[model samples]
Target: MSKMSASNLKLLQPSPPQDGLACRATDGALSIKTVGKIYDPEGVHVEALRDCSLEIAAGEFVAIVGPSGCGKSTLLNIIAGFDNLTSGEILLDGCPLATTNTSPSPGPERVVVFQQGALFPWKTVIENVTYGPVVQGVMSRAEAIQRAREMLSRVGLKDIESSYPGQLSSGMQRRVEIIRALINNPKVLLLDEPFRAMDTVTKSASHQYLLELYSATGKTIFFITHDLEEAIFLADKVMVMTTRPGYIKKTLAVKLPRPRQYAMLAAPEFIAMKADLVGAVHEEAVKAFEAGEREMA
Candidate 1:
């Protein structure tokens, strides 16, 4: 996968419109219009999403939370262009994204980071980080190395360039994967429970690290997590989705201040917001559970 040329990069990231209205702007914006997805395996059809619609403003950090089997991962996959929508459309910068589109297939413009860091065991930290740029011929080996070092330093991993993935802690490996994605200057970053496998302490550290990274870069992010606290703490807006045949149930605006701290979780305001989201998610979970029981019966 080659990198987009400098001109193409500029075209993808035009400056935001002068209008103050968020809905009318398209620069770096993502719009999903009444999208639906269905899977038919062995002639049995299953609907994953139905009439789901959302619009994310440029540079917004949006987190989604829902019960298991709610098609969260499916939605993320569609946005990453790995899968196609069964109905409606997904537009980035007001341009539709489809599996058949001539637009470059799932390259640096939008990158998805999965739960596992997925680093190569044989490659050193710097090697893994620079792999994309080098493979794409976007930069020479020396230039890629230099760029990787700068990013590593920004994330405070300057000393581990030569170390392999096995030598670093799980948290460090996650950081490396994030840096690798960011090095491409992607317009959007999609995270699918990237911290799910980490211990509590490590998860907390990664949260802080991610917050710092977001502050520094202001990249658009769409994060999916089952953890309610994590969703509220990290996002400017929390979107809750219903069970299978999922559609967004509600979108909650988080008024929490920037540079959020762990202490904020204990505040009354934070607790109230969490309680509201918890109620919404609990309802969906109950519905999902009942549906499962019916299938078993």
Candidate 2:
């Protein structure tokens, strides 16, 4: 997908801060304090988020779920420094993230992977993977290529290093995008429904690959997805958001053991967790649907 499409999709669209949590900004991790976002389109003010707060531990994987248009993407954009929050602050490792410093700019410690793999079609796979490190001057060209090749091999994509993005399958392309972001070793990785468009088998494969990468890298990740099962299967904690003017409704811890497998989805604990989350999400979904109906009327 083009950058324009990604932005349009995002424009069309977490938790309470507490002490003692390793994710707490006070503990030198990621923190969100009463963050809010509003948009004025043609004099109509739309509130997207309200008093949203959440803290993620240094290496925690948190998956956020909410009704469509609940500002899940908006939250990700703010965390990524792509957009400014109207109210509240976001801090990374105890430092507030400046809203004015846009991404791919200097001193951005976060990288985002959109639903559509944002790859430069003209650049070969290796070049795309190494782009961030090269641009950020994080490593020399030779070192970047070496690191990219190693990451690709770890994810089983080493053989396609010379191919253009157009030459790879959708799944492969997504993996390349992930490697591209990961190569920078950013402190945080923001994923906006990266697997939503893939086939089930492909999505499942991507999930396992991501878990492996997360285990190896220990990078904190904020993942947004509408899939309840996916969230439970992949995240250390699953955060549910309410309808428009989104806020954290609940946070559920997934106790399933890792090296997680698809089979675990059938386990009693997994099913129970999904049941509770489904109930929470359904309540907000109803509210969102009613709000839309009223708006049309």
Question: By summed lDDT, which 10 consecutive residues of candidate 2 come out lowest?
Answer: 8-17
Backbone clash pairs in model 1 (N, Cα, C under 3 Å; residues 3+ apart or in different chains), count: 0
Flag regions of model 1 displaced more than 4 Å. Answer: 1-27, 99-104
After TM-score superposition, the amount by which residue 10's alpha carbon in candidate 1 deviates from its true location, in angstroms, is 20
Report the Cα RMSD per candidate.
Answer: 6.8, 9.1
Which stretch of 10 consecutive residues in model 1 shows the poorest summed lDDT?
1-10
| lDDT per residue as tens, model 2, 1-297 | 111222222221111212433333323268888988888889999999999999898889999999999999989988876677788888788777844343313243588898888999999999998898788775789987887886676667869999999999888898899878877756788899999999998888888778767766667889999999999999999999999898998999999888788899999999999999999999999999999999999
Q: Per-residue alpha-carbon lDDT of model 1 for 1-297, expressed as tens digits?
A: 122233433332323323643323234578888988899889899999999999898889999999999999999989987787788788888777643333425777788888787888899999998998888887789988987887787667889999999999999999899988887767789999999999999999999888877766678899999999999999999999999999999999999999899999999999999999999999999999999999999
Candidate 2 local Cα displacement, residue 176, angstroms: 0.9
- Model 2 residue runs over 4 Å out of place are 1-28, 99-108
